[model samples]
Target: MNYQALFEQIKKKKSFLCVGLDSDMKKIPTHLLSSTDPVFEFNKAIVDATADYTVAYKPNVAFYECRGAVGWRSLEKTVIYIKDNYPDIFLIADAKRGDIGNTSKMYASAFLENMPFDSITVAPYMGEDSVTPFLEYDNKWVILLALTSNKGAFDFQFFEENNKKMFEKVLEKSQEWGTKENMMYVVGATKAEMLSDIRKIAPDHFLLVPGVGAQGGSLKEVAKYGMNQSCGLLVNSSRGIIFADTSDQFAIIAQIKAKELQKEMENLLIEYSIL
Candidate 1:
């Protein structure tokens, strides 16, 4: 989807929420295990339940890829279901893939061309060649990892080169390769305070923020600094929403959790005059 359509959905839904479908087989309700395509079934239920309160659905690829071939099949089924049923919802493949030139092109093609995701999370450690391949696709987004919420992010993301932090350089230099319309940065919600500085650099690009609920990232702080003119944030909650209740009513509980976030988001959008 293009940037205009994304903002349109956010306005229509009164939400900027992205539900994470990290549906681990071991974590889902046992009853779903009896189904032939347990993962897809679980995802379909979650999507149906929370579609009203969400503008996006992000599927963590590691959860499915870990299960092997069956897992891949389940992932495909889940993707097809979302594309067919909720064509307007922004679909993200949370596959942090980055490699050398040719290989990067293949990964980009696999997700952006074959699978039909609007965006895919990418790692930028290998520099321009590793990431630009993903940017070559029109209307496809490359969400590069920058200032993540994890503890280990401080190890390398802060490294200095020519007196600038590594992530600072990532934000500054990447603009030369892709416009805000096609490139975004993954700034974890836990780093909300730093967003003031980040916005100074990338001003208009959207941010895919994870680590909100289960990881204790504050929504208030994120909105305080991360939001731009179009409410440029897609806050994600994985285990907190999807695994809210591991029972027959799991999807219902997920909806409630999503609604709670949506309510908060609605208020923020209005406060920022984006509504």
Candidate 2:
């Protein structure tokens, strides 16, 4: 989807929520094991339940890849199912892929061309060559890892040189290769305080924010600092929404959780004067 199309969805739904489909097989309810493809079945249910409240869905590729070829098939089926049914929903391959130019080109084609993902999370450490390949596809996005939510982020992301942090350099240098339309930065909700600084650098580009809910990232703080004129945020929640329950009513419970976040997002949009 294009930038305006995405903003339209956010306004239409009164939300910018992205549901993370971290569909780990072991975490799914045991009843689904009887199904032919438990992971896909679980994902189908979760997608159907949360579609009304979400503008995007991110499938963490590792969850599927770890299961081998069978897992890969399940991932493909899940992506196809979302696109076929919920065509407007932005689909993200949370693969965090970035390699040498040739390898990155293959990776980009594998996800952006072979599969119908709207975006893919990419590591920026390899610099322009590794990330530029993904930007080759029209209307597809490359979500570069910037200020992450994990504790380990402190090790390198904050390292300074001439008073500029590593992540700051990543954000600055990356802009030369991609624009707000085709590129976004991953800023974890846990680091909400740093958002104002991030906004100064990327005031208009969208931010794919994870680490809400289950990770204890405050929604209020995220909006207070990270929100922009276009509601440039896609706050994601995974375990706290999808895995809220493990029984037959999992989907129903998931819907409730999603709706709760959507309602809060609507209020945020209004408060920020972006609605």
Candidate achieving the largest lDDT: 2
TM-scores of the models, in the given order? Answer: 0.98, 0.99
Instruction: Tell me the lDDT of model 1 at 83.
Output: 90
Error of 1 at 262 (Å): 0.5
Task: After the best TM-score superposition of candidate 2, give how far the Cα of residue 191 lies from its true spot, in angstroms.
Answer: 1.2
- The root-mean-square deviation over C-alpha atoms between each candidate and the true structure, in angstroms, is 0.8, 0.6
Looking at model 1, the pairs that clash are none
Candidate 1 residue lDDT tens string, 206-256: 999999999889998999999999888999989999999999999999999
lDDT of 2 by residue, 1-275 (tens): 98999999999999999999999999999999999999999999999999999999999999999999999999999999999999999999999999999999999998999999999999988999999999999999999999999999999999999999999999999999999999999999998999999999999999999999988799999999999998999999999998999999999999999999999999999999988
Candidate 2 segments whose C-alpha is farther than 4 A from its true place: none
